[model samples]
Target: MISGVVVKHFLYCPAIVRITELGFEERVTDSMMEGEEVDKETVGNFLFGVLKAKELIRKPVYKYKDLVGSPDFVLGFSYYYSPLDVKYTNQVHMDHKAQVLFYAFIMEKLGFNVKQAILYYIPVKKLVKINYTNYEREYVERILRNIVKAKKGFLKVRQPVRKCANCGYFQFCKPKRVGNFYEREF
Candidate 1:
């Protein structure tokens, strides 16, 4: 358990990102290689769009609360606030209710007004604006309270997730291996 003093407060951790992203990309490549048909969900294209937008604007980018403790993208604008987070999801807009609210909270805590939050859809080249309303603000604060409790093991895992062979951890978890994949780890 990490103490409050050592808790990583910033968003973008380069070391963690390198390790995790590489592992995920390796898995994706292995499954997608040799023209194997797999229903994979990815948000690379949406991230690209964010990058394109950033390139157009001359501002610093950072991932805060990272292991290194910095914003994901810190930009230098006339306004003091320079924190922005890019999230990609399959759903159009409202599905990302909890996460966007959390990001807004992080910004507020760091003394940023957080004027805008962008939710980009992968399948559709569409962007959605997340406004921090009073309702969402209160709701997210309640959720954050519950989340802190859960992190301390005061919460129980929700059950009844649909069983599927496609999830990567199925082999280790001993889920049904439809195509002999259950027997072989390779």
Candidate 2:
């Protein structure tokens, strides 16, 4: 079963999905991967703050079929719980939203009111609150469905030319170079 982290990576780059399908595990490099330290520190701080204000569950693991994930923090109120994720990036990404939304979906199905996904950006020190819209939900659903299909013997390796440099698999892939702004019109 693919977890939310796997889905997030797959959505970030199709090449990542291919790499995982090929059973390539990411090796820890000497240098920090982007946002590693910040994620750790911020999560700690968030846990502290939330625990002081209200009941909070840290890293609660939930599994729904092929999807398995643990949200960084689940803020529990009298009748509902909200999914919160700590990120090091200054801005929120679709992958972040998808990860949180997946958690929210699982919580909602368990009869909890999950109205939005919250992100705490470390650098900016701000909470980027996003409503769990149907559109975003559908988007996440598609990503999960594709992941299932890939597990069933159908998977395409995505190698975005522009993203090769920052990718952990860059040395192995050596994809054709492209500018960051490069885009192919469908």
- Which number leads on TM-score? 2
Q: lDDT by residue for model 2 over 43-84, one digit each (tens)?
A: 756655754536777678887765677888787756656788
- lDDT computed for candidate 2: 0.68
Off by over 4 Å in 1: 1-89, 93-95, 163-186
Report how far off residue 50 is in candidate 1 (Å). 11
TM-score result, candidate 1: 0.45
Which has the greatest lDDT?
2
Each model's TM-score?
0.45, 0.76
Relative to the true structure, candidate 2 has a C-alpha RMSD (angstroms) of 4.4
For candidate 2, the per-residue lDDT at 1 reads 72
lDDT over C-alpha atoms for residue 175 of model 1: 34
RMSD over all Cα atoms, model 1: 10.4
TM-score of 2: 0.76
